[model samples]
Target: MTLNHFDDQFEDSPQAHDAERAEDLFVLLSCYLDGEVTPEERKQAERLLACDSEARQIYQQLSCISSGVQLMPVAENPVSAEETTAKVFARMRQQRQRRLAWGGTAIAAMFVAAVSGLSPHLGPNNQQFAHTPAPVSEDIGNLAPSETEPRSEQPLNREDITSRALFIE
Candidate 1:
């Protein structure tokens, strides 16, 4: 058969008259209440309500259930003020302890760096090097090349060194 004939047959079928078919009317009514039903569904629901009192009653019952479900009281657990305060205090203490630990680690790192910097200067092995005497003038003379030998001329002094010193007469 053609599509139109099949639609007519389905509409006239015994199954379509069953109470289970009222569920469609309930769904349409819920969508209507929620402002979501399409124009075609709204027209179909109106036609059903005008033609079938049972379908209309079912739609009304579903709408009431929807509204009732939305209005029902929700249960909430009771929390005391003292309990909330204690929770806040505990969180603050945890944060404070973390900050103190990080600060202490930074301070310890700085101290280690300071000690490392001073270690080479103050170490026991460095004492002998620090106390060693200056080389004898004759030994320094032996190590130097002869000053009478030809060498590059020194750059002239830009300023006299004695000019910086003040001697009171």
Candidate 2:
């Protein structure tokens, strides 16, 4: 196997343990800078930062990153709250007017369709309807009455009603 430039003879050295500790220290430094660490953790990070060059370097990098992010621009809308609200309401009104216009147009189209469909029967020259009433004969009063018809306009009693009543068992 080809050995790299930094390769050393020792396989079981303290470098691996130090690398893990450095990673933990980086996290501790980041938390400390963000003010997320507790009092005990803050003291631990401070002690590490004071004694360890790697921890101090990580803290400096984290500090720079945090400050750089804070310096970045966050866009703030220029329009006033009232203006934005008015614009939104205006858009809504426009939509409502459009819907109403479409609905009215649909109703008018349906009305025209109905009128066109029924035009043949409702035309001026159609002979289905008659203006004058049908002629009635004068002999209607003189015609003979059936058994179901009343003989006279006399007031009916219980006995008279029994004569015409059909009973079901």
- Number of the top TM-score candidate: 2
- Clash pairs for candidate 2: none
Residue by residue across 8-62, what tens digits does model 2's lDDT show?
4332468866777888888888889989999999989989888989888898899
Worst lDDT 10-window in candidate 1: 127-136
TM-score against native, each model: 0.33, 0.38
Model 2 ranges with Cα > 4 A deviation: 1-13, 78-169
lDDT (10s digit) by residue, model 1, range 47-158: 8879999877887887888889999987587678899999999999999999999999999999987887679765545654223333346665567778788877887563
After aligning candidate 2 to the native by TM-score, how far in Å is the CA of 11 from where it should be? Answer: 11
Top candidate, metric lDDT: 2
Residue 136 displacement (Å), model 1: 91
